[model samples]
Target: MKVQAGELLQKINYPSDLKQLKEEDLKQLSQELRQYIIDIVSVNGGHFGASLGVVELTVALHYVLNTPYDQLVWDVGHQAYGHKILTGRRDVFDTNRLFGGISGFPKRSESEYDTFGVGHSSTSISAALGMAVASHYKGETDRQHVAVIGDGSMTAGLAFEALNHAGIENSNLLVILNDNNMAIDPNVGALKEYLTDISTSKHYNRFRDDIAKVLAKISEIGPDAYKLAQKFEKSIKGTLLKRSNFFEALKFRYFGPIDGHDVEHLARVLKDLRDIPGPKLLHCITVKGKGYSLAEKDQTKWHAPGLFDKITGEIKKTVYEKPQPPKYQDVFGHTIIELAEVNPKIMGITPAMPSGSSLNMMMKAMPNRAFDVGIAEQHAVTFSAGLATQGMLPFCNIYSSFMQRAYDQVIHDVAIQNLNVVFCLDRAGIAGADGATHHGAYDLAYMRCIPNMTVSAPMNEEELRNLMYTAQQDNMGPFVIRYPRGNGVMVDWQRPMKAIPVGKGRKVCDGEDVAILSIGTIGNEVVKALNELNAEGYSPAHYDMRFVKPIDEDLLHEVFGKFKKVITVEDGCIQGGMGSAVLEFMADNNYRAQVVRLGIPDTVVEHGEQPELWAECGYNAKSIAQQVRLIGLTRSMQTIAS
Candidate 1:
C-alpha cells in the first residue's frame, strides 16, 4: 500500500496529538504507524522487526501515561522507532540511523521525553530505578517511573540485579516485560522457559479472571465480604501458580502475561497499575514481527531489514562487479571452523551475538565445538576461561563495547591465569552509528593494563586471518585480535595465511621530516593522508603498529632517529589508548622527540557515519594531512627563526 493519502497519521505531528484522539481510533493509528515504519524502513534500511512488534505497546503507553512526565525508558532503544514517530519525530523517520540524522535509539538530547539515553540492553531498569530513587529523594512522589525491557534484555544479569534492588527498596516503579519470545534468534535459558510456561498457562489467567469476577459479584455483601474476597483471591493465586514466583520473590507485585497486541487491554492494565502500590511488573506477550507477513515468517531476516521492495517485501540485492572476501567477522568465523577442524580443543563462543560475530557459521560447521551463551557477556568470558583450563582453545567472540561488562573476567580469569584463549574483539574502534555507548574506544586502555594479555589489531582482512592463525598457534597466554565492523579492504585471499611476528610494527611509507604511526583500521586512512602529503612535496614516514600492548619500541626508536616530530593516529580514546602507549614508550626509553597525539578526545562522540566521525575527530585523510602539514610548517618556521 501506497499509504492512504492524508491519513490521520500524516497529521500526527506529535504524541500529544495521539493522546487527544479517541480510544477507538487507536487501532487505525497502529496500522498507520506500522505502515509508516514499514515504508521508511523499506526505503532506508534499519531495524524493522523490533519497531514493528512494539507498535501497539507504543500506542498504548503514549495514550495511558503522561509521557515526558511519566518516564518511559526503552531498554535497548532499537525498538523505539514507533515511540519516536509519535513523539514529534515523524517527519525525520526517513533519516533513521543515517549520518547526521536522527539516531536509531532513544537520545535524551533529542527529546525531553526520552528520559535516558540507551543503546546497550538491560540498562533501562537500572536507569529507571535511579530516576525513581531521585524522585523519592526529591519528595516528588507524584511522578511515575517505568522501564520497558525486552525478554532478551531480561536475561542479562544487570537487569536482574536492578530488579533485585528495586524489589528490596520498595520504590514505586513499573517494569513492563515485553516478552516477544525472541532476541534476534530464539531466546535461550531457564527464565525464557519459565516466561513461556507462565504466558501459556491457560489455567493461571482463567482462574485469576474467574476469581476476580466472583469477587466483584460479592461486593454487594458489604466491606467484610470484600475483605473475604481479597483473602480468597490471594489463596487461589498462590495455589494455582505455584511455580517459581520470581518477580513476587523479588518483592514486585506481578500482574500478568496479557495480550500485548490488544492496545485497549494494555492501556487498561497500565491505567489500573498506575495507582497500585510498590514495584509492579506487567508481562505483555508480543510477537517479534506482528504485521508484516514476511517479517513474521522470518523475524531474524527482518530484525534489521535492508533496503527492500515494499510491495514484494523482498530485499534489494546488490550485484558485486567483483566478488570480495567475506566480512572480517566471516573470515574469523571460517578461520575458527578450519582451526576447530584440525584441533578438537578449539571452541567458539559468543554472548548472544552469533550473527553479529559470524559465529553462526562455526556453530553450523561444528555444533559441539560452538556455544551461544545468550545475553550474558560476563558469563561468556568466565565460561571461556573455564574451557581454557580444560586445555580447550576457546575463541570468545564479543563486540568491543560489550566486553566492558566482562572486564573483571578478562583480568582475573584469562589474563591472571595466562589462559590460552583468543578473544576476537569485533567492532573494535569507532563503531560508526551505534554512538558513544557502543563505540569500542576504551578496550585498548582497559585490555592493555591486564598482565599476560597480548592485544593486537589487524589492518585488513588478510592480516586479520594471519593474526588469528598466530593467536591460535601461540599457546603462551591470552590473546586478543581486535577488528573493525563492516567490510575490510578487499585483498587477495588466495595466498595462505601466515603467522605475523608478535609485537612487531611495520613501515608502510618512509619519509624524513615527520612520521605518522597508526594502529588498526585507521592505517588505510593514514596511508591516504601520506599520499596527500606526498602531493604537497611533504613525505611523512608511516608505521602500522599492529600491537597495542607491546609498544613496538624498536619501530618507535627507528622513527625517532629518522624524524624529530611524530604523530600517532588511532580510532580510540587518546587518554589511555594507543597514543598514551606510544608517549609512555618514548618517555620510558628516554627517546627525545616531539609527539602529537591524534585520536578521539576524552569525551562522548555521538552517532554518525564512521567517515564523518573520523573527519570530525581529525582522523580522515584530508584532516590528518592538513594537521601534519600545519605541524611541519610550524617546525619549519621555528627552524628558520632559530
Candidate 2:
C-alpha cells in the first residue's frame, strides 16, 4: 500500500507486471496513471479528458484480467492512452501522434494488449462478442472477453444489435459500459436520460429484487393466481423501473451503476464478474474529465486542449502578429446560423459532433432547428432524410470517416429518394492525430459512386461559403461539400455569399507547359507550386476542379487539347477520386496525354502533422513542384520527337 505509483508503473511493461502489485497499491497507481496522462497530453496534446476519466478502470482491468490472452477491447481508443503507456509503450509515449510515431488510437499491430483496433465508437461490444463466440467454438470456454464501451457509444444501433445477438448466443462476455454521459460533446437523447435514472436509482433495484422474491411465492402457493401476478408484476415494473427494466429483458445479467473511479471496487467487481457465465453488462458510472479540476469544469474544450499547462490548466496559444483565419468548422458553424436565419426550412444535424463540427453555434442560436442525434450515425442519416421529406433542407454535418457508418442509409433513404439533404463533410482529408482509422480519405470515392450525389470540395474559405450558399438553393438531389481539418487559408473569408455555377472550374494561373488539375483544399498546395514554378520559369496551368461529380468537362477538354501533359492532385484516395475521375474522362474522350495522378496511395497513413503526411503522400507544395518539373521535361521530349 505504501508503494509509489510512479515506481510501480515504471516496472509495469505489461499487465502481468501490474498484476504483481498488491490490491491496495492500485489506488496510488491510478493517481500516477492519471497524472502521467495529463503530463504527456499537456505538451503532446492528443485526447486528454477521456484517458484521464478511465484511469482507474484501465488500471483495474489490466490488473484483474489475464490480458494478451484474455481479450480486452476499448470501444473508442481515445481512452486508451494510459493503456498504451502501461503496455510496453512508456518510452515512446512522448512521440504520440508525432510524425512516424505510433497511432493515437489502439492498433492491433501496435500491441497484443490492444485486442482489436478501434477509433469510431460503439464497436467494442460487437468485436468482443465475436471474439467470445470464437473462443466458444475453439473450445476455450473459460477465456474471458471484455468490451469497455462508453455511455455515448451505447446510443448507436450496432451496440443494441450486438447485445441482442449476444443474449441469444449466451456467450461469456463482459460489457463494461463506461457511463460517463459524454462522447466528444455532452451526450443527447433518451438513452442518456435512461442511464442517468439507472445510475441514480440504487434503492429501486434492491426493492425490485425483494419484490420479485415475494412475487415468486405466488407460483408455489397457487398456479392460477401466479399467472395474473406475473403479468401485473411485469407491467408495474415496466412503469416503475423503465431504466434497469430494458437490459434485463435483453437477457443480460445487469450489475452496478457503481462508482467507476473506485479502483478497488472496480477490481473486485470485475473479478467477481469474471467467474459469472453468459452475457453480462457492468454499468460503471464515471466523470469524463475526473482528475483535473479545469478539465472537469470544461470537458469539451478540455477533451483535447492543445499544449496546455498541466499545473495552471491554461492552454498555450500562438500569439499571431496578424489576423488568423478561423477553422473551417467555425466558418460552417457561423454560416449555418446565418443561412438558417434567412431560410425557415434550413436545419442542422450532427451525430455526436455538435461541438466538433461547430453546429453547437446553431444549436445555441436555434435550438429547435439544430439537433445532436447522439453516436447513432445510421439514425442521424435517416433522421435527416425524414426532415428532408417534410420540405426541410437539413445540413447533415458528419465527419467524413463517421459518414461511412451511415453509407447504407445515405444510399437507401436519401440518395435513392433524391432528397435535398446537404452533407457538410468536416475533416474530409487526413485528420491528424486520430490516424488512419479517422482519415477521411475515401469519402470522395464512395460518395461519387452514388447516383444522385453531387460532390465538391472548396479550395479556400471563400469558396466554402459560396458553395454552402449555392447548395441551399433549389437542387435536384443530395449535395456534398467536403473541407479539410484546421484553419482555412483566407484571412477575410466572410465575403458576400454568391452562388457558384455547378460543374464549372476557374483557371488560377495559365501556362504554356503542363496543366495541373487539383480538387478540394489540396488545390492550395497546387497554387503554391504554381507560384514557385513561375519563379523558376516553369508555367504549369493551374485549375481548381471544384466539382468532382459533374466534373468541369469543358475545362478538361481545353486542357487536354492544349497541353499534352497533365498532373492531377487531391487530398482523397487516388483509387476513385479526382485523379481517377480525370483518367476516366481522358479515356472516354480518347485524348492521348501523359496523365500523372498524385494523391494518397493505397496505404494507411499513420499519426502525424498534416504537412508531413501531405509531403509523404507527394501532394505538398514542394513535392508538387518536383512532379511538375518532371512533367515539363517529359512533355518537352514529346514535342522534340514531333
Candidate 3:
C-alpha cells in the first residue's frame, strides 16, 4: 500500500526543497514529516518513538544549516528517521531496516547529508568535532558542524571526553543536547538530575525571559546597545548561571532549556547559534514520543513497537496457534529473579539497558540488588568487578555488541583479578534489524580469549537456567554466559534449575556415518537438521558443546575416534569462535579430521530477520541439512574411489 505524504511533505524532496518553504510552513512541514514517519514505520516496522520525538528538531536543523556542506551527525542514529526522510530518502523510506535495503541508522555511503555514519551512542560529538576541526584546518570558516545527542547518550564518558577536547579546539562545533530524558528507558545518573535542575529552574527561566526582552529591545536600539547586551548576557551567565551549569565548567557556551517542539523558535535559535564561534551546546528539552499520545505515556514500550496501527495506536504482534516459547531475554529476566531470590550474594547490573537486557524484572523484584548504570558500559563492568571484590556475585547483563565498549574493564577488572562476576551477554548472535553495529557476533571469540573466563552459551531456556545456576556457585571465576535474541526452542521453559558441570557437553543422539558438533542455541538448528536427515535415511551423530572455553575434550575424543568427517556449527563468527575452538582441540590432540565449519563468515552481515540472516550466513536448519548431505555424498564418492 502506498502511503501518501502530506501536501507540504510531498514538496520537500530534499533540504533544498525545504529551504523553499515559508518560515510559517515549517510547522506544517514538521507535522507532515511526523505523519509520514508514522505512515511508513507503521507498516514497514523499525524504531518508532525516537524518530517521532525528534520531528521538530530534525526540521529546524535542516532549515537553518547548509547541510552536506555544513555537517550534521546524529548520535545513536535510530533517531535519524526524520533526518533521513528530509535528506532525500523519503521515497524508499518504506524499505528501512529490511535486508538489502536502506539501513536503520545513518550511513556515510548512503547519503552525503549523513556527515558521519553512526549506530552506537555518544559518538556524534567526537565525529562532529573532527569535521569542525578539519574545516578549520582547510580554512572553511563558514562551515558549521552540529551533533544532535540525546541526554541518555550524554551520560557516557565518551561524550564528556569529546566535550573536554572540543572546548580547546576553537572549532565551529555545535553540540545540540536533545534532552528528552530517554535512551530506550528513562535516563538515570547525576547528569540527569543536573539537567533536570537547569530545565526546571524558575529563577533561571524568569531571568532568561527578562533578559531576552531586554536583548530584543537593545538589538532594535542600535550597535552600541547590542554590544552592551552581549556583555550583559555573558555577565548574567557567569554570575547567575555558570555556578550551577555543568557545561559552562567544561567551557561550552550553554544556550538553552527551550521547548524543542516549537519549530519556528527552534529554527530562529539555530540560525542565531550558527554565527556564534567555538564550542556551544543547545539544550532543547523535548518529549521522547512527542505528537503521539500513547507513545508519550509509555515511551519504552513504544520505542520499537513493530508494525503498529497509527490510528488506533495498537502495536501488532504475531499470532501463534499454540503456546509459544518466551524470548531469551524474558527467560533471563525471570531466571535471574529466581536465582537472586535464593542467593543473597547475587546482584544485577546493566548500562542503560534495563529493559532491553530484561534486567528490569530484577530491578522491579529486587530494586536494591539491581542497578542501571546509565550509558556507561565501562563503569558497569568495573562496578560489577567492585561488587565482586566484596563477595557480591554480580550478573552484569549487557548486549554482546555493547560489551565491546568494556573489553578493557572485563579483562583488567574482572578476568585479570579473577573476580567471580557472571557476565550475561544478551543478544548474542545476529541481532537482526538494528544491523552490524548491534549484532552480538563477536562475544564467543572475545570472551573465550580472556584468561580465567568460563565462556558458555545455552541451547534452550532450561540450559540457560542451569548455566545461571552453575555460574553463581562458589569459585567459578569470571563466568560468561551468552544467548541470542528472540525465542528459545523449548515451550515449557520454567523448569527447576540445577547446576551442570563446567567444561561439559552432552550427546543428543548416537549415529554411524558422520558427526556434527555445535555450541549454544545454534545446536537447536543442528537438531532440526538431524530430524530432516533421519527422514531421508541419513544418520549423523550430534554433540552439544555447552561451554566454548574448557571445551569437552572427552566428547571431542569420542567423536574423533568414531568419525573422520565432522562439521562444527555456531551462531557466532567462525574466526576464533566455537568452530575454531573445536579445530584447535582436534589439532592439539593430533587427531586428523575433515572438518567443515558453518557459522557467520568473515564479512559484514546487514539487517534482516533472524531466520533470513541464518540462511544467508549458511548455518540455518536447511543449510545444515544440505551440508550433511553434501558431506555424505563426498564420502560415498571417496569410498568408491578407494
Candidate 4:
C-alpha cells in the first residue's frame, strides 16, 4: 500500500528543505510527518509510539538548527524516525528495520545528521557534550550541539554524570529533556517524581518564561547587571519554587516545562536557547504517542507494536493453528511468580524492562518483591546483589545485550562475593529486527569466563522452569540462565518444574557415525537436522549440554569414546561459546576427533528475522543439515581412498 505524505511534509526532503518552511507551517509539517511515520510503520513495522511523540520537536529542531554541521544526538534513537524522514531518508523510510534496510536507531553511518549512533538509553547527553567540547576546541563557536534525551533515559547515572561535567564546561550544548515519562515501560525512580513535581508546579511554570525574559534582558545590558540578574533569578526561583533547582545547582541554565506539542513555541524557544547557551536544558513535556489515540492510552503496548491497522488500531499477530508455545521471557515471567509463591526468598528485578522481559507479571502479582529500576543496568545488578546478601534470592532479569552495561557489577558485587543472585538473561541469541546493537550474542562467552559464575542456557520452556528453580536453591552462587527470544517448540510448555543436576548433559537420541553437542534452544535446530540426516541415511547422535561453565565432561568423554566425528552447535559466538567449550574439553582430555563448530562467526551480524540470521550465520536447521551432508561426503571419500 502506497501512503502519501501530507502536502507540507511531501515538500520536506531534508532539514534544509524544512528550514525553507515558515514557522507557522511547522505544525502542519509535524502532523504530516507523524502520519507518515504511522502509515509506514503500520504497514512495515518498527518502533511506533516514540517517533510519534517527538514529531513537533523533530520539526522544531531541524527548522531552527543548521543540522549536519550542528550536532543532534538522539538518546535511545527510538524517537529518531521523524528526524530520519526529514533528513534525506523519507523515500526509503518504508525499508526501516528490514534485513538489509535502515536501522531502527540513529546510526552515524546512515546520515551526517545522525551525529552519534545510539541503541542503549542515557548516552546522548555525554555524547553531545563531547561533540560540543570538540567544536569549541576547533574554533567552531557558532556550532550548536544538542542531545534530545527522554525522561526515562534521564534516570540513568551516566546522564547525571554528563550533566555534572557539562555544567562546568563553556560549550554550546543544549540538553532537551524529552519528558514523556516513559522508557519502553513507565518511568520509575526519584527522577520521574522530581520532573513531575517541576512540571506540575503552577506558580513555577507560569512565572518561569516571564522571569527568564527579564533575566535575559538584564544579562544582555552589562556585566554588573548579569551578576545582579543571576542573584535576582535565584532568589525569585527559591521563593516561588521552594526548592534548589537540580540542573541550576549543577551550574546549567535550565529552561521550560513547556508544551512540546506546540511546534511554534518550541521553535521559538529553541531559537532563543541557541543564542544564550553555555550548557542549558529545555524540559519539554510531551505525550509519548501524541496523535494516535490507542497508542497514547497504552504507550508501552504501542512502543514497538508490530504491523498494526492505522485506522482501527489493531496490532497484527501471527495466527497459529494449534496452541503455540509462549515466549521465553513470558515463561520466565510466569515461572518466577510460581517459584516465588513457594520460595519466599525469590524476588524479581529488571532495569526498566518490566514489559520487554515480561517481569510485569510478577510486578503485578507481587508488587513489593519485583522492581523496575529505571534504565540503570549497573544499579540493577548491584541492587540484586544487595537483595541476595539479605538471604533473598533475586532473579535480576536483564536483556542479554543490556547485561554488557552491568558486567563490572556482576563480577564485583555478585560473582566476587559469590552472592546467591540468579541472573535471568532474556533475548540471549539474535534478537530479530532490532539489529546488532540489541542482539544477545556474547553472554554465553562472557558469562563463562567469570569465576564462580554458573553460566547455563535452557533448551525449552520446561528446562527454563527447571533452571529458574535450580538457581534459587540453597548456596547456588551467581547463577546465569540465558535464553533466546520468541517461542519454544513445544505446544504444551507448562510442565511441572523439577531440579536438574548441575553440569549434566542429556542425550536426545542415539546414533552411529557422528555426535552433535549443543547448548540452549539452538539444540532444537540440531534436532531438526538429525531427522533430515537420518532420512538421508547419515546417522548422528545428539546431546544437549545445558551448562556452559561446569560442562558435562563425562558426557563429552562418552561421545569421544563412541564416535570419531563431532559437531558442536550454539546460538552464541563461535569464538568463545559452547562450541569453544566442547573443543576445550576435547583438547584437555587428549581425545582425537574431527570437530566442526557451528555458531555465529567473528563478524558483526546485522538485523533480520531469526531464521534469516541463523541461516546467514550457518547454524539454522537447513545449514545444520548441509553441514552433516558435507561431513558424510568427506567420510565416504576417506573410506573409498583407504
Top of the candidates by TM-score: 4
TM-score to true structure, per model = 0.94, 0.94, 0.97, 0.98
Model 3 residue 509 lDDT score = 97
TM-score of 4: 0.98
- Give the alpha carbon lDDT tens digit for every residue of 529-561 in model 3: 999999998999999999999899999999999
Off by over 4 Å in 4: 215-220
Count the clashes in each prediction: 0, 0, 0, 0
Q: Name the better of 1 and 3 by lDDT.
A: 3
Put down candidate 2 lDDT per residue, 1-642, tens digits, no spaces. Answer: 122337767788878889999999999989888887887888888899999999999999999988888899999898998889889987788888888888888899988888999999999999999999999999998899999999999999999999999987767799999998889899988989888887777655554444444453554666577657656656655666744466768877666667889999889778777755688888888988899999888889988889988888889999999999999999999998889899899999999999899999999999999999999889989999999999999999999999999999999999999999999999999888788988999999999999989999999999999899989998647999999899988898988899999889989878888899999999988988888889988888899999999999999999999988899999989999999999999999999998889999999888788888899898999999999888877767977999
Model 4, residue pairs in steric clash: none
**C-alpha RMSD values across all candidates:** 2.7, 4.3, 2.0, 1.2
lDDT of model 4 at residue 118? 95
Off by over 4 Å in 1: 1-6, 208-242, 634-642
Question: Compared with the true structure, what per-residue lDDT tens digits does model 4 show for residues 287-350?
Answer: 9989999999999999999998999998889897888888898999989999999999989999
The alpha-carbon deviation from the true structure for residue 487 of candidate 4, after best TM-score superposition, in angstroms, is: 1.1
Estimate the lDDT of model 4: 0.91
Task: Please identify which of the two predictions, 1 or 2, would achieve the higher lDDT against the true structure.
Answer: 2
TM-score (C-alpha, index-matched) for candidate 1: 0.94
